[model samples]
Target chain A: MTQSHLAPEVMARARDIVALYPHPRSALIPLCHLAQEQDGWLRPEAMAEIAELVGITPAEVLGTASFYDMLHTEEVGTYVVTLCTNIACMLRGAYELLHHAEESLGIRTGSTTADGVFTLEDAECLADCGRAPCLQVNHRFFGDVSPEGFDKIVDDLRAGRLADEVPHHGTLVRTERDGGLRVEAETITAERRATAAAMAERAATAAAASEAKANG
Target chain B: MTVTDAPKIVTSRLGYDDSHTLERYLATGGYEGLRKALSMTPEDVAKEVDAVSLLGRGGAGFPAGRKWSMLRKAPTSYLVVNGDESEPATFKDHLLIERDPHQLVEGVVIACYALQVTTAFIYIRGEFALGLERVTAAVNDAYGHGAIGRDIFGSGFSIDIVVHPGAGAYICGEETALLESLEGKRGFPRIKPPYFPAAIGLYGEPTVVNNVETLSNLPWVLSNGSAAFTALGEGRSTGTRLFALAGHVKNPGVYEVEMVKTTFRDLIYAPVLGGGIPGGRELKAFIPGGASAPWFGPDQVELPLGQDEVGAAGSMLGSGSVVVMDDSTCVVRAAWRITRFFWRESCGQCTPCREGSGWLEKILRRIEDGEGRESDLELLMDISDNLAPGVSWPPQQTTICVLGSSIPSSIASAIRMFRDEFLLHIKDGSCPQGPAPHG
Candidate 1:
């Protein structure tokens, strides 16, 4: 590699992620997600940097990146707009939203605007069946969007009126777990184990008998 | 007549105050099942699940207890919870993870305790940002309460759950592909017969891969008796299922229905379910399952919404995603859209899926774009035959995974059901009804 592209802190976090799994190679996808979040896309240099961190070749990294759809191998715009045009969305005016987006942005489905601000693409199902015609800006969900709604969001985004709507790549929602954890010391007596073992023997025999009857 | 609406088991706490929090989950007696399972032996826990006849809710409807029984007894077994709800029109698992994240964690704790598994992974879909965040925080909250870490509930049972997000691959919903993605590889389906996840999966150890909804039912099965769980439905298809109703319905949302109790008519026309088709239009056809499932005519609306009945009616109850299409919808265009999904999502590992899906899309696009020949109809069927090679309900194909069959299921069914529509396109050189179906 020419020079170390990843920041020192990013590299330190990458090492910690690698340490999470027993096999370091299992951290390849997470590390790639980290690099893309930093660079907005997976650049060749970023791939090389990740390969160094994960102890694998750059080609190995590319092979995995190319397989997944979200990992961009090339440069993307600042705001990546992905509209779900799959079956459920299509039934609820997704094509209209896509066509409206194409006309308003002056770009095709898979192309970016000339200003390098918006990249538009038709995505598959976003798993928001309740809200059809959904779209995502940098993977954040905007459900039940109409053409007018689409234009309004774009206008707000361009004008910086709604900055928090579009987060950086790979950043999802922001929520933390609450503190009232349930733990009791008196419940763990030796008597419970004996009762549990006897129940297990009866359950196993019943399961075996049922298995035989089903096979028969 | 509509089937009586049963109480929501999975979504019971959906709209409760602080539903996604560990506090609310605890107040509702969430980890009581895990605590009970920890008190019992692992085999008994598996038996309790088996007794309930809880089928995998992530499509395929395989018995969860049978899957647990097939564990290879390896010392290093792993539990993989599939939250990759990417089946088009399906979002029940997404709701489960977002609304009741700790419910899934509690299920994982019990499952790992039963299988003696230490390491478990929740493979959430990459597109699901809210789900990922909710599940991540839930895992942390679980750890804080000693619900997931060593000596859970002070029962000396240890399990750790890692929330791993997928990077935009629809095929990763397949259990084998999910395992491959967990190993940091391309999400490709492993060949069967030798590579079942139970025998060899996730770092070459015995693995149990259960769907999010399937695992979420564990706490219920362990808390209530197996007979109580089974009494909710009929026959082998017992327990409640989360049905994601979308498309031309007035109320397009997820509903929990007893497996054998609910019917297609109830899901589509019942006021409590789909609220009947939108605009009061006559239902022409609908996908009984996800897009991969074949389209069924309105005559089959009375069919029960279960695996056996739906499969007998020539469509699998896949992911329980019902996408209704009114008479205003064009059948040929719908088939093309579904076919294009399979074509794009094909992993390119198998020849039939890679090449066959693309060719089917091109032909359908040509037919839809008003540049069609009568022979293109025969050509589409021929291409479908080459991919699946049978007209059976579950076509006998030669691809690595069901994704190969998915390419032809919608196409073959559309041609069989709407030959006149295809002929009209060829006759008029376009969609006879309109110009390319705007919206």
Candidate 2:
């Protein structure tokens, strides 16, 4: 394996990441992160370089990189749409959302679109189960997404409207109030609250029922 | 009424009407464990833990007290609480961390005080943002109350608790891999021997890595003494285990019980446990441990649920996460989903695990999708056999880590218990259980 294809900046970042760990070989993960951040995907030569930088054999680096689901080893589209398909999300139409995405994009899960603009992959629980049927475009989350809503977002992205980057928690809406900046409190609509409460209640009921059956 | 017996090990003081709150914890004598531990000699504390024979809650089941004893020789020791809780079907640690953060915090303090460590880290899963916040708040409260950080309780014992969030990697749940991530790197678990965390761990200092539930048991052990803790369970495996029950159960959550006291039938038929399968359906099979263990079908002896019994049955009581499968579940499909999970999360460190997991996943997926080859079933078995224990990989040919062996154990168990089900998937071109979504 060759180790000379990496950009100087990428190498510098990898070196910095490697320095963060006491053992250089332990830096393989962070170095891969830097490689992904710079090149958008882990190339063969880059992986080899990471192995050399981390003081491990190329095969060892490849082995570590391939075990995790999140690390992208191959080339991906400009934007990656990762859908959460864990149990919590599965109950909330995540399957339907995934199917809708596959249909709309004309690409299967783990495959990039023909245009090379989007790649769809199924992810484990994204911890946003409170708002299920969620998808992430480049690390930004779009929660409580319906099929139509997802299609609209994809269409917007296709038309070049960059998805707004927001924090996972806290409010997204900001407003100016009398010469000062004010962040809008998240409004819990009656309908949304009712739906959320109902979901919680259903989960509790299911849990109780499961416990009862187990004990009985 | 006078009760003279020793208290239970894990749940001796836990589970009294939603007593997860800090106030309730204090009222029920929670932090007293830490106080009691702080007054004891570190060596004596380690001995007591060793004598009790408590094991790791994270699938491996290594003796906890022995692991702590191994860390005693390191000059600057650190205690790491493995809060990753990433195993697919396991949720006990999540409950312990989310519902009882202070108890875990108290345990950390006790462990640190015993080991004479100055710092502790909680490497929580990135998906557990809420859990992270809860634990971080609890740690802050402990610091505020002078229970943690510089000179805790004026005993000259200082410890700092740092919450390191993992970037959603299942493999990092392994201790060495967690240390890598804590050092601001990607989370790849290291092969043992030369890289065991105890000796050459975390910047080359002695480190003690324990599961969240294992550490949570520390306070009780400290307060009640080793004899009391050991009295709860059968020989060797002492204490209560928090079984995270799920799938086809009337109730699916964390339940604390004595290690060997509960039976498989008791957990299944008991209305408060698993509700005897769903809709009066017969229990077809169950993953006695987490996703990594082998499946036990109805034909298998319905024995007591414990480490010894489960191990004797050729599976482990891993993480105490019992995932039940009813008659409605197709074993082949279950195996496929589980193989897919391993393939997706293999960490790709070894060829047998990385390539073999992918192969198993592909074969199982094809079989599930009605694209079966007659030889694929045998091929699946072959691949699994290659990854099984005693099998070696290239460079050494022997398997590197438990991650490599876990999937094979599961696949073999699935095959042995449900061979007919696998054959049905290949012959009928569809699951006999039909097209229902698995929970």
Best-matching candidate per lDDT: 1
lDDT of 1: 0.85
lDDT of each: 0.85, 0.70
Question: Alpha-carbon error at A44 in model 2, in Å?
Answer: 19
Across A129-216, the per-residue lDDT of candidate 2 in tens digits comes to: 4356677776566777999999888888877676444221111112101111112345446667889999999999999999999999
Question: What digit string (tens of lDDT, one per residue) describes model 1 on residues B1-439?
Answer: 5666666778889889589999999999888888888889998998888888888898888999898888898768899999988999998998999899999998998888888888888889888777888888899888888897777878877776777878999999999999889888999999897646899888888899999999999888888768779888888789889899999999999999888788889888888888988776999888988877888998898888888888888888989999999988888888888888898899999998899999988888888888888799889888888888874678776799988877788888888888998888888888854555332
DockQ of 1: 0.34
The clash numbers for all candidates, in the given order, read 0, 37
lDDT of 2 by residue, B1-439 (tens): 1112334445544456555566777787868888877787777887888888988888878898778777747557778889888776577776677678888999888888778887777877755545665676777667767788777787887777766555568778888878777764556677667645778778668888899999888888888888878877787677778777666666655667776766777666676555566577778787787776777777553666567777877778887777777776666766766677777777766898889888888887778777788998778777877787432221113356677777766667777777787788788987664542322
Please identify model 2 stretches exceeding 4 Å from their true place. A1-121, A125-216, B1-24, B389-397, B432-439
TM-score of chain B of each: 0.97, 0.92
Q: How closely does chain A match the true chain A in each prediction, as TM-score? A: 0.77, 0.71
CAPRI-style grade of the A/B interface in model 2: incorrect
